[model samples]
Target chain A: MSLSARRIIPGLGLFVLMTVVAVWALWPTGGKVTINDRARDLAAELRCPDCEGLNVADSTTTSARSIRKDLLRRLKAGEDEAEIKNSYANRYGESILLNPDGGGLGILVWGLPVLLLVLGGVGITIAIMSRSRSTRLTPTESDREEVKKARGK
Target chain B: MKYSARWIALSVGAVVVGLGVVLAMQVGNDPRIDATKSQLVGQPAPELSLRALDGTAVDTNTLLGKAVIVNFWNSWCIPCRNELPALKEFANRYRDDPGVALVGIVRDDSTRAIKAYVKAEGIDWVIVTDPDSRAALDFATRGQPETFALDANGLITGAQIGPTTLRDLESLLGSAQGR
Candidate 1:
């Protein structure tokens, strides 16, 4: 194969891989009526209102059981996962969500660390480049001796 | 230039510490950072029709013209027990008030336990059971001892997430009235 073909083939493979991953993440598992897999996955994402820091799927509390039942009902009703999540969020304010919304203050909480990391990377890159350039212009021993004698060292 | 870089670092550190302190102060004042606040306030209360501990069906629609106090509690909850005396007193105070109704919802508990508690506590108000917790879920309760005050049109006027005193219940009930 030609060089360009070889490079393009790998690039195409990477693009296809990324597309599959993205689609997998956004795929709707909400309409699945199985009581265990999809329903339980969705339940696990919901906060158990009566239990402290426990997800609905994990809690044995009656309230959690009810919530799980409600979730299954909605799923069986053919509601989309996002729709079910939004329904709870609307009734409970955004705080009820185990995962915060992508908008508003949640964006800040999620974005700040990534922003700091990128900025730190740029700073480190600049520092390394400047240090390397200065080292490349290193003075000879004669030059150092001349400077030392001039300074009466 | 080196001194300036150090100064910038120091300033950034100071700002971070200052922000942390401000957040710390707020943490004490607002411990419900993870708790869901009432989104039902000012919204029409969801339909609640459940079997009372007395085996009678109690529905919110029948009490449409009356100010309603819907309290969600369970027999097992300590906070629910703690607020029972205040809740009882509030119920008695409003017992003669035909314009107001106080309804308590027992969550995730048996009728036998509730009946025993109600008799022992002398609770003379309407206490209902949320069999599947549909009403509690609709109300978006975080924990037990949550209370919601609704106006005559069945619109929620106020909501309390924790145990409330008689004064608070009175204020919540009063606000729902004449509105």
Candidate 2:
């Protein structure tokens, strides 16, 4: 209802909106997860050992084809996503997954960027808040006396 | 705009993070290679049964109590061709050694092509045809010229990728406790 209140509300709304946009844009991107796409999606995370820089989902090599077939079979057998992934990892080690694991040294690879982004956001918000506070008008002694006189009248 | 310490810190952090990622990608990274050898080693070799070109049944169970060397190859693979001579020689040297067994599983090729290559190379060892490549897949074979060395207990003791040599086979067989 007050003038300052209205301005502050819109500014807060804008800050929140910008944050949501940044997170949505910078967060990890993955395809839609569905039963039909499950096998293919997991396959995309596996690299073809026979081919250079090719994922199993995109490779026609025998190794890739065999892995894809096994993945599909496991999926149909009602295996959990992590179970299927670990199956390959058990055989191949952590490197089998296209995405690094969230634990161990792999945590650094997946976490550093997110941590930096959040830190950057917090830093920017602090800088902006401090700048705004410094520039805003502060009530002087004369201004306070004028306010008191107005209140008395 | 002046570059602040915040920006410099972020830049340094980013470079470090980038370097970490690049280094991580290079470490233990062999996407093309499945964990077959690592996982299968110390575990029993998967069950396999295939008929040779002569229509004789070759079963893994029968080959127990002897060190089994299962070599997966295809006629189309150049490395497979190159490794054939060494394999034949190894088989010949160990022909009288009942403790050693060398078996070749032909993959992804027609019986005719496999038989012709076997006869031309005089492989002489147990050459079996893997009709649908089911056996090779069971062994987690990535491509041609991958050989698996199994101990007398049927446990996989060694896995060699690429074109293998006589020395490779010797080393594998040498470390095999069964031998």
Candidate 3:
């Protein structure tokens, strides 16, 4: 084999191995989805009606326990998750869900942080790149004079 | 500063200030549930088939022509105790009126304690036990002392949280339509 091909082959193999490992690690498990698992997952997203700042899964309040049990029963009865969640949101208010709806005012609540993060990242990158460029500029006559004066002092 | 750095700083500052202003505007954002604005309002009250303390089967499905006042309370709650007099007065006022119905569901309390309290307080209204807190869950109650008034059509007309005064109860009853 050619020297360039020999050098590139191991790096390509390593990259392919990394890509496979990453895909396998990030892929969701294909295990059986049980009613209990669905119920618990939904419960984690629902707010506890009687408690302060606690979701149904974490709260030990009677209302939380009752809701969790009700979720399991609903799931077992072949009701879809959206049907159950909508029923809850209808009975209670929209605040019952830990995460707000994706539409309407929920868009602002979920989108603002990400937008701000991107803007901030762009600003930082620009600042850093410009700083590097500025540092590379050669010293002018005035700059040398100032440096000499400082050195003399 | 370089031109790019200055622009970046200005934009960042502007965004930070904008975010601050937006957040500052929400300083008065109330997280607590609004008492006057229950989601159940204008919706039919959930069907009830619960057992009362005195072995009476209190089924709301049977009370079609009467307005229902479902009050969720517990003996341990101070607000529940505070609102007892208003409720008792309401029960006395509506004793002979078949057009109205009052049902008090116990929340997170024992039957023994409720029975004792009912006996001592002379609570003649339909006092029911919420097994597994089913009624509370059905009603979507936040806590004790939350009351809901349903009109004769089984539509929830008014809902109130916290200790309610006699005047408040009267206003709630007045709001119930379709009677």
DockQ of each: 0.29, 0.21, 0.39
True contacts kept of each: 0.48, 0.27, 0.54
Pick the winner on TM-score between candidates 2 and 3.
Answer: 3
Best-performing candidate as measured by DockQ: 3
lDDT of 2 by residue, B1-179 (tens): 12454674777687687877778777885643444454577778888889988999998788899887888888899999898778878898999999888898886788898888777877788889875566776776656788888898888898887888999988778756554
Q: Tens-digit lDDT track for model 2 on A1-153?
A: 975677579889998999999999999777766665888988999767556678989988766777788888888899978998887776666666788789866777787778777767766766655655565678999999999999999
How well does candidate 2 match the true structure in TM-score terms? 0.76
Q: How do the residues A73-119 of candidate 3 rate in per-residue lDDT, one tens digit apiece?
A: 99989999999999998888777888877786567688878877887
Clashing pairs in 3: none
Candidate 2 scores an fnat of 0.27
Which segments of model 1 are wrong by more than 4 Å?
A1-36, A108-153, B1-36
Arrange candidates, best DockQ first: 3, 1, 2
Q: Extract clashing residue pairs from model 1.
A: none
Better structure of 1 and 3 per DockQ: 3
Candidate 3 segments whose C-alpha is farther than 4 A from its true place: A1-33, A120-153, B1-11, B33-37, B177-179
Clashes of each: 0, 3, 0
Name the 10 consecutive residues with the lowest summed lDDT in model 2 chain B. B30-39
